[model samples]
Target chain A: MNTTGSTGLRPILERHESTLLANWITAQKAAPTYRPDLIKENELRDQCRDFLRALMQAVQSGSQNVDGSEWQPVRDLLASISRSRGKQGFSTTATATFIFSLKEPLFQLLQQEYANDPKVLAEQTWATSVLLDRLGLYVTEVYQQTRDSLIQRQQEEMLELSTPVVKLWEGVLALPLIGTLDSARSQTIMENLLQKIVESGSETAIIDITGVPTMDTLTAQHLLKTVAAARLMGADCIISGIRPQIAQTIVHLGVDLSGVTTKASMADAFILALKRTGFAITRPTAGR
Target chain B: MERIPIIRMSKFLLVSIQVDMHDRLALALQEDLTAKINETNARGVLIDISSLELVDSFIGRIIGTIASMARVLDAETVVVGMQPAVAITLVELGMSLPGVRTALTVERGMQILERAIGPTVTEGTDAGPEE
Candidate 1:
């Protein structure tokens, strides 16, 4: 090995000397089959490492080329690194380090190879940015789709819970409603109850809500709307199963249920419906 | 007009009012119906108002209160036989009849009661009378 460093190459090697030594050792071990003359190999390795270190520093510091001599060292290094890694049984880490060490010099080579083509540079940048943006957008879209599906499932569950069962009593229709009432659920309840009232041709509809946990203004309003819709179909709506808490909430909220008929419980609502239809429930005589 | 006698069905009482009845008469019918419902220990009371041409807010409030009162007594009240136009008008005016069960016709109201009684009672009755 030449103990005297080239005057112009000394600074470049000093800055990246350790990294260059590691890369050179890796390259030698990777290509154990190659039997290049010892003197030539040593000279080529030192020259290549010095050239690459200088090229990287120049590129990072935005320095101008140091005459046409720069191309010679880069070309030789590329040929050697590519040759060594191409051989069988090259360790991946050694090959990767050698390749990465040549990045700055390779870029310089590419710039010279396409020197007259501004369009190539523009296209390369555009393609890189576009690929990056598209990858980001794909990730975002997948997240949103997952969130939307979860919400849809929740809404479906609410609809199922809000299903109103229409029970026929002597021609009157009683819709027994159980479950908590949210805005979405209440809307579904109204739509279903109204549809049943119209389809069944029933004159009375009793809506029992004893199972509801609590009532808010929105729930109360939804109930009113259901009653109105039922009545519009020429069916009277009776609301039953009001818990004391719910009633107090309605009263405290100052919500006027003045025109809405109410039953205390499901049974009461049904009996009222029976009476309206002229079905008299008489006890069986002691002796037939 | 023939007076429709108040009758009890299952746990409910029914008072059928004539169509085109005066508002005062309807109000009186509601009161009388409620009183009868309370006396019979009926679970519910239905006032057949199919004949009324108009349903105002006052009547609605009274009906609502009666329903509420019946609820306190462990009974319910329903207003039956309301016309479509009347129903629409009341809703348009933001009026809700509180304590009453309103039905399109009296018969439908009865069916509503039967269903409310559930399979246990309905099934018991569904069995043919014993020989």
Candidate 2:
């Protein structure tokens, strides 16, 4: 160990790797960032041990500058750990603490190794803190990116799942729209409903908005666009589940519905659709 | 390019638009359709656009003009089989095509045309003689 000006962490880490790992894990569990409920002791211990090995390897390359290619292995290791924790629903702070927890144990080893030289101890500690901070930030960046992509994928899946087009009858189709009708979701709904209309050869489409929470101007325009598209495709669109409050809002907003047919419920719209298609439903009581 | 052929079926003119009509071709069809309506004395016109993938505002206006001209010539016009995407684009472009009638298919368009012209106009149907 070159103790004069060489402050690489390789010597201390190699000498007491197991002890330092155990201390680091103990300190980690004691911190609020650690969640034992999401992971087992053996798993966390394995990650910490692997991380220490990579850190020691990087330091052994004899490079004090963390930005150099020698420290790339350590960065790669931290990034992979952060990605795993990101998928496990770990918060950014918790994931960063995984790298930061090694600080205390490393500082302790440095203090003991350089007890006679306070200036070298302070210098080494400061360098370790700056390097650890950089590594912590890298982990957070990777974790945030993973989380954002995960959220966007889930949102797309939900949008596709929320809007479903059903074939009500031979000449009739139904679209049940649930949740807020943003422009993107509205585009999805329009495409889905129109595709169903074409496939089923249905002349009438009933749009059920019972699951929709509110009626805004944009949503109403989206509905009109869908209706108009259906009409152009040789299909008539009937909007159903217009609650009293929504009716008041539509009237207040002055959205035109002169060419559109609105019904209080899906059943009424279905009956009207059946009538338009020249089908009369007769319930025979004696047969039952 | 060949002009769109107008095939007369019973008392109606069937214009199955199998090609993507440019502005000139559409106008030529419009002129030919009205001229054929006057010569044949057709009661209805069924414009089948199932094969057409696009419809801009100019094409949309031509369709509307044809329908209005057919109405003035004492004929009903039903445009059928418009693709859903084309319809959405037309509506988005602020042309709902209020002047024309639409049906899901040519057969259904004939049914609507028969209904509009009255059931008696439908020749050789199951109910044409009975009703």
Top candidate by DockQ: 2
Model 1, span A76-149: residue lDDT tens: 44445444443423344333344343334333433444468767644433433342243233333434444566
Cα TM-score per model: 0.40, 0.88
Model 2 agreement with the true structure over A57-148: per-residue lDDT tens digits: 77777776666898788888888888999998899899989988889988998999889988888888887887788888889999999999
The residue-level lDDT of candidate 1 at A250 comes to 98
lDDT of 2 by residue, B56-90 (tens): 89999999999999999999999999998889889
Q: Name model 1 segments beyond 4 Å from true.
A: A1-133, A179-187, A280-288, B1-131
> lDDT score, residue A59, model 1?
37
Weakest 10 consecutive residues of candidate 2 chain A by summed lDDT: A1-10
TM-score of chain A of each: 0.49, 0.88
- Which run of 10 residues does model 1 chain A get worst, by summed lDDT? A1-10
Q: What DockQ score does model 1 reach against the true complex?
A: 0.19
